[model samples]
Target: MTDPDRPVAIPAVPRPKDRPGRAPAPETTSTYRLGQGPLRLPLWLRAVILACCLVEGLLLAAPLLGLGSARAVSLMLGGFWSPLLGGGTGLYPGQGAVMFLTYGLLHAGLLHLAMNMISLAAVGRELTRMIGAGRMALIYLASQIGAGAVFALMQPQAGPMVGASGAVFGLAAALVGHAAITLRRRRRSMAPLVRAVALILGLNVALTLLMPSIAWEAHLGGALTGLALGLIFAILPRRA
Candidate 1:
């Protein structure tokens, strides 16, 4: 028998084997990805450059390959001044419009083709980057048409004209306009852009004077159209 003040001993409890415990969460680490933009050329630039090269190559090769006469090709595929003149306007309505765009593809010689293609690549890449492929195309087409119309108005009696000079000038002017807008956005004056544009115009004028065969009218028209388009684009919201 236990005494009234004596302590009692308690039985030890067994540990459970199947009790659930909190599991450590799966380990995770942060990851990052780098973008590829500068390395890639836009599809529109590739297509246009390739097409220009191919068209010029085929034109040059046609005579050697016995496919056709180079002169005949130039007269037929090249833009003619006939529509501008009062001579045989029998061509269906809007035919003249088609010729305006095609004229840009035709060049007088290998040298002519080379110069135009080089300028196109240089200026086109910049404009493409600035305004994107679609807008670039619109500006180009409109420039071509404006050049043709201006040339016809100024030189209705002039001989057949061909080459991408008008379009090239347009791209140059477009660059100037773009630069001006960008500078203005930063609270800067447009003097630099204006000077650059003036220099370009002066050079073109000298070239025209030196080479009377060059169509000054077309260049001026294209440049004006480009300036307008660039200003309009500058005011619009931009997207990536």
Candidate 2:
């Protein structure tokens, strides 16, 4: 009561950690700490993933819905066929052109879709972060078209090519290209890049030897396209 003439003392509040046997309260801020929250994917990336899943889901549910086997129907309607490029008749007109983009959305099976989507998510997330979604999307589209063209050119009699392997490969190649450029800027050895390229080629060769059905031509085409674009992007000055 008499402290008003001198100084007033206030007891300090006890922190959660200061309390005996009491643990600290969990953080409730809007920001999340490192490696603690759910991964937030880009909108476009999520949309792409959802679209692929939806297509696959619909295909799986086709028979249950009394639509009969839809795999063949979907492939015929959307799969990339080499003959179509050479003026072959399609179930619908303009399908030949549309197949260039649509083929990437179709997959042979769940395993195939899973592999492609995983790769897309991993590499795509990094690339999208480096270059905005628009450019990443552009790379993906260009890669798909390039892949289809190369597949058609190389395997003129090959069966319908489905899956996003080519686009994923393209994204990987772009990542490698960017890495190569960054290393070159630092005067580092290109051995790592060379090894990475060789490793990809070796993997493709191994997969082709084992499966014999892999569309390696498309992979090659996508890698080439992505590498070319990546190099161009790396060399160019960044925008302000």
| Top candidate when judged by lDDT against the true structure | 2
Task: List where candidate 2 sits over 4 angstroms from the true fold.
Answer: 1-40, 189-192
Per-prediction CA RMSD (Å): 18.2, 10.0
Clashing pairs in 1: none
lDDT of 2 at 110: 94
- Encode model 1's per-residue lDDT on 181-205: one tens digit a residue: 8888888988877787788878888
Question: Stretches of candidate 1 above 4 Å error?
Answer: 1-41, 82-87, 90-94, 189-191
Candidate 2, TM-score vs. the true structure? Answer: 0.80
TM-score of each: 0.75, 0.80
> What lDDT is obtained when candidate 2 is compared to the true structure?
0.84
1-240 in candidate 2: lDDT tens per residue? 343345344545444554667776654424223344445667877888889999999998898999876989888888999998787888888988999989989998898899889889988878876666777787888888999989999988775899889988988898888888989999999998899889888988998899888899999989888888888888877676
Give residue 120's lDDT in candidate 1 (0 to 100).
Answer: 79
List lDDT for all candidates, in order: 0.74, 0.84
